[model samples]
Target: MDRQFYIISYDIGDPKRLQRVHKFLKDYGKPVQKSVFECWLTERELESVVSWLADFIKRTEDRVRIYRLCRNCLQNVEFTGPVYFAEEPPEELIL
Candidate 1:
C-alpha cells in the first residue's frame, strides 16, 4: 500500500467543536502546530478522515483544509524554531 502525506489545518468557531476535531485527528496523525496536523495515510484513510470531519464541522462557520504532499514536497520541507514535531515520519508507527 502506498501512503501519502497530508497537512490538515482548521479554524473551527466553537471551542467544543475544535477540541472534538483535534481529538479525532489524533487517531489519524501527529500535531505539527496548534491547529495543524501531519497525516500519513492511504487514500481510503484520507477519505475516512474527511468524511468524519464533514459531519463534525459547521460548513457555515468552520473551515478545514487538507494539503496533500508529494514525496518530493515532503523531502523539501524546511523547519525552523522550536521542534515539537518530528522532521520525518517514524519508520514504524505502532497502533
Candidate 2:
C-alpha cells in the first residue's frame, strides 16, 4: 500500500481529552511537538484517524487539523532549533 505524509495538530479544551487524543495519536504517528504529530498513513489509516477524531472531539470545543504533504512538499520541509521532522517508516518489518 502507498502511504503519504500528514501533519496532524490539535487543540483540546480539557486536559483529559487532550491526553486521550495524544495517547491515541501515538499509536499511529510520532509527536513533533506537544500537540503536533507527523504521520505517514495510507488512505484507510487516514480515514480511520479522521473517524476516530470526529467521534471523540467536541466540535465547539476542540479543533483538529490534518495536512497532507506531497513528495515535493515533504522534501522541502524546513526545520530549525532542536526540532526535526519524522522519518518515513519502513515497510514490512519482521521481528
Candidate 3:
C-alpha cells in the first residue's frame, strides 16, 4: 500500500477536547509541535481521520487542517530544530 505524507494541525477551544484530539492523533502520526502532527497515511486512513474529527469537534469552536505533501514538496520541508520521524512498529511473526 502506498502512503502519502501529511501535516495535520488543529486548534481546540476546550482543554479536554484538546487533550482528546492530541491523544487520538498520536495513534496516527508523530507530533511535530504542540498542536501539529506529521502523518503518512493511505487515502482510506486519511478519510477516516477526517470523518472522526468532523463528528468530534465543535464546528464553530475548533479548527483542523490537513495538508498533503507531494514527494517533491516533502523533500523541500525545512526546519532548524531537532525533528522526529515516526517509526514503523516491528513486524511480529507467530510460529
Best by TM-score: 2
* RMSD of candidates 1 onward, in order: 3.2, 1.9, 2.6
Looking at candidate 3, what is the lDDT of residue 2?
69
Worst-scoring 10-residue span by lDDT in model 2? 79-88
The order by descending lDDT is: 2, 3, 1
- Over the stretch 38-57, how does candidate 3's per-residue lDDT look in tens digits? 89888888998999999999
What C-alpha lDDT values do all the predictions have? 0.86, 0.93, 0.87
> Higher lDDT: candidate 2 or 3?
2
Candidate 1 vs candidate 3, lDDT winner: 3
> What's the distance in Å from true for residue 91, model 1?
9.1
* lDDT digits (tens) for residues 1-95 of candidate 2: 68899999999999999999999999989998999999999899999999999999999999999999998987787778785667778886668
| Model 1: how far residue 85 lies from native, Å | 5.8
- What TM value does model 2 have? 0.92
Relative to the true structure, candidate 3 reaches a TM of 0.87
Judged by TM-score relative to the true structure, which candidate is superior, 2 or 3? 2
| Poorly placed runs, candidate 2 (over 4 Å) | 93-95
Which should have the higher lDDT, number 1 or number 2?
A: 2
* Per-residue lDDT of model 1, residues 1-95, tens digit only: 67888899999999999999999999888898899998888888999999999987999999999999998887687879864433444556559
* Clash list (residue pairs), candidate 3: none
Judging by lDDT against the true structure, name the best candidate. Answer: 2
